[model samples]
Target chain A: MSEAVEIPSGTLTVTRPIGVQFSWRKAIPWLLTGPLLLFMLAFYAVPVVAMLLRSVNDPTWTLAHFHALASDTVFFKVFSNTLYTAFTVTIGALLFGYPLALALVRTPRWAPVILIMILLPFWTSVLVRSYAWMVLMGRHGLINEALLALGTIERPFRILNTPLATQIAMIHILLPYMVLPIANALRQIDPSLPRASSGLGATPWGTFRQITLPLSMSGVAAGMLLVFVLALGFYITPAMLGGPREITLSMLIDLQVDQLNWAYAATLSAVLLATTLAIIGVFYRLPGVSNAFRMGAR
Target chain B: MRRFPSSKHFSRRTAMGLIGAGLAAPYVRPSYAQGAWPEQTSIPDILKGSGELRIATFGGTMQETQVKAYFEPFEKISGIKVRYFPGTSAPKVKAMVETGNVEWDVAQLSRGSIMNLQKQGEYFEKIDYSLIDDGVGKEFRFEYGIEMLVWAQVLAYRTDAFKGAVPKGWADFWDTAKFPGDRALLGTTGGGWPELEFALMAAGVPADKIYPIDIDKAFASYDKIKKSVVKWWDTGAIPIQLLTDREVSMTSVWNGRMAALQAAGVPADISWGQGLSKRDAWGIPKGAKNAANAMKFVAYSTMAIPQARVAWGIPYGSVNIKSNEFIPEARQAVLPSAPAIKSQLVNYDYDWWIENREAVIGRFNKWLLG
Candidate 1:
């Protein structure tokens, strides 16, 4: 059915469908997303809510686990350790990734080869990569043997089972996450802008600083957010390469779960989730990050 | 190039023989192609059942050994089919029991782990003592489970690193001045419980009096040697690797792991002195669908023949005392159960660990960070 409606503008009239056919177009997006939303609600949302509820709901509804965590020195220490490691690894990845991403996007002839080198190791399992790190960084490992042969130092330098090893391996593992996004952003930059700046008598460094760098801020922000969040929850790499004192919050959660301390583990997990959400919230508040997300939505 | 045989050359008699061999293959496929598996132990008719028995085990080469040792033959001897699920842990068992969805009929775990969950709630079935073979030692039998595999946590050291010197116990392990090398110990990072027993022994506490462990004192001892430990290994392989790489001159290693290290001719040796002997038990979850089959399988696997097969396959010791007769003397010399080695190992008290683990682990994390 069709109907004619008079507009507020004097005598203007419009014809419109007045039946079920008119509303169906508006429902298409929902219809497409309905199954996925339900699946996520059932598998992801429900479990997470249940897990959070478990922190206070198990054994007669109490927040003793969280309260205990507040006074627990180990919890504080491990939590701080996790944050510090994540921060350091993120910064390291950004420093290494930006140059690599620039190289990836700038060098047209070698882009595929460079991308392959970055992704080949990324395809390997984290566990296998961590073990490779262990082998390479060990006291008598290849690096040390070469150094010793060169007479760089009389004693083999201890690198494995140290915080340094953990940071190095984590940065290596997380490099691709930081690189791909920045490369995409860099490629999206209008080539004419930098060329125009140069055409206007601007120096190459000046053009890069004012035009190229500022435009790729969104990419840099996105990469940092990704690498930082992933590093925060790292378990295997740290456990394999870190020393005794390098215990992270994830390792602590694992220990509690193994001990059957469900409530306590739930509390620790909730805290980790909260911390991650808070960090992302802060990132979203930043201009560059929000702009990047808005662009991503488009 | 060589020409291949043609199907046209096949005769009627040859075809019939091929069919006969093909039909017999499933039955005659050797379960023990490497050597003779100890003769199959007899089982009661009641123990023979027709159903699937899902067994959960710690995966890897260990599961490979179990397949040859008992899984295949047990399925053949009893009417029950054994299905293996690897990556079994006590925590997983607890979660299954709690969810009322027990995936495994039986799981291989430590007595302490089973008892820890049992103490929390009803998680395990009361093991059928009558179904278990007589060859199993009385000590291995428990109310909720029966120990089928015995292993030890021992002090392993590089024989060449110490200039022909030997580390006898934890005290020597602690003495960096005497041994003069880096060390590694078991850490909780890898799902391993803290090595408090070793810590106490390092503090000069007698092995016999180690029960009801003094946690504060143990940490106090750990403080002294914390800097010396280059690594706090979680997996059994980590210690072996460290020792082989000379990353640590001495480390706490599993007895079973040491056999392979020795076989590889890594100049490393294990000292049984003050080592803690640990056992792995077959625990049936309370609501298992195939509990009957699980009971039967447990009984069959712990018998002399099957137990010997496991010992032959790996360096781990057998709970069935009678299995010793079937194992060669050369092999027995390295087993944790051999009298010479067994006498030196301190019997680990699972009950004590079960009661104190939560508190001790909390303290351990703090102490480790400190």
Candidate 2:
């Protein structure tokens, strides 16, 4: 090494070769990513852009479809109902999922068995699951049979075509999606921090509230976003279990498509897409949410 | 280092060129192409070698039995393979026809659906009248399609609910107090529109001058019975299920389905009086890959013997006059297109209904959503 002579005030000497730098290797990674970028552009981006164009243009730059949707009270009611249903289901999933995930993390030996139970419904088709719910909820179905046997009621209640039935089916379907992500996040947290807190005379609940909960906030946020977005787009369960009055945006889209009103369908789809994006944006902006999303990846 | 600017410019130019090509490629490729339909080809030569002639039909036990009865004998006699596809719909038919990669050599379609396809043009091949018998041709003639099966949409009521006070006409059906229980109707506005119109006529609108139907009046009539309707069924099976399960007191069901349900010991009865009978026809798609074989299959399917066999197996009536000769008089009475059943049946205005289907269905859906 050459000794540095201080001639100028703030001059530095470079010794490394330019070829062995970050910029050079960056090109290699980009080349590897090219196929995925192209795939996303072609399949995902193009179709979405096309759908947007279809929604607005529809052979001419007309707001007719949007006007129809906005003017119709049914549209607004359905839209609100979809959001409210999603909110309730997401909260339900989080409440049920967080405890189960904690139990899963605490008991390592029984984890696999419990996980299989959680994942079994996910493996089955949604249609089959909805039909199963139908059998359970129908007038002369299993639930009614049991209730009548217990002398609960003289006549079977109309439970099959109700919003409560829709909620039950949706929560059952979306629970695993929430639990799996949260459990993974909870598992990754360093055990010593909570242990350190407890060792310092912090009570068990106190340590959990101060350290565990804050750390697990990332997972909770992630699970909520996942479950919420999925719930917004659910079509089959609501249609099968819920009454005509419980039709969602997706069911409306189906109605439009079935009626051969493709333009109207496109418009409704765009609305759903916009709503999902807005929710995602809100999720991203929440305190420490972005950091949480990035934490486990690296 | 000195050549960097020139190389950069070259790279930029190449990138711009690639972007331009990528943007323009899809537009450059023509998506719509038209060619001669039913490519004139030898029928026997193409089908002679192929082991199976793939046939597509709506799936169910009835369709399955019909396929077995009709196609199996043909397969044995002609040494052709028979492939069956169930639950095919109009959109699937349109896609297959438009793409010109039709897997179905022959298909069954409702009269309204065939007319809808014909309106699109270039989706179906013109029927070759020469293949049909003259008597059958004169009796069940259509321009673009050959009639296969006929069925009536009639009132199927629970005997337990009616207690011998059965509904005779649309006015009686609308009389909720007299026939009080949950009623069921087909979900589609177009499908059940004619029956509803007939009901309106039975309520007092004259049949001969029932054109330009007052939709508002029709809905007003429907509203009286709407509250009593428990569900609107989308499939044939649903109405049968409704009647058999006693979920609804009464529903309009296909005559054949009602027969099948009755045979299965379901406490349901059908009234052929003032029933709306419709025909399902067979047609070859335009630009069909195997036109000759399709025609041969069409001819084979429409023959009296096969039609009678299909009727015997499925309980649906056939359009063939010869099929009437084959069935016993007792069984013939139940057949919707039989001379006796046909006399009592009201002919649906296929032309008017086909023309107004889109408009009627659109308004109906909006009303339903409301």
Q: Backbone collision count in every prediction?
A: 0, 5
Query: Best by DockQ, which number?
Result: 1
Clashing pairs in 1: none
lDDT (tens digit, per residue) of candidate 2 on A57-102: 9769999999988886666777888999999999999999999888
* DockQ, model 2, C-alpha based: 0.09
RMSD of each: 9.6, 12.6
**Candidate 1 per-residue lDDT over residues A1-298, each given as its tens digit:** 7787877786887787765664777989999999999999999999889978989998878988888989999999999999999999999999999999999989999999999999998887665576688779989998899899999989999899899999999999999989987887888788899999999999999998999899888889888998898888887677668876888887777778778888998999999999989888887776676655444422
Q: What stretches of model 2 exceed 4 Å from their correct place?
A: A1-88, A193-214, A287-298, B1-54, B75-84, B96-105, B135-140, B161-176, B189-195, B198-212, B240-246, B255-266, B271-274, B328-334
Error of 1 at B56 (Å): 0.3
What C-alpha lDDT do the candidate models reach, one value each? Answer: 0.83, 0.68
Q: Write the per-residue lDDT of candidate 1 for residues B32-105, one digit (tens) a residue.
A: 23556576866779779897999988765567789988999999889899999766778888888888999999
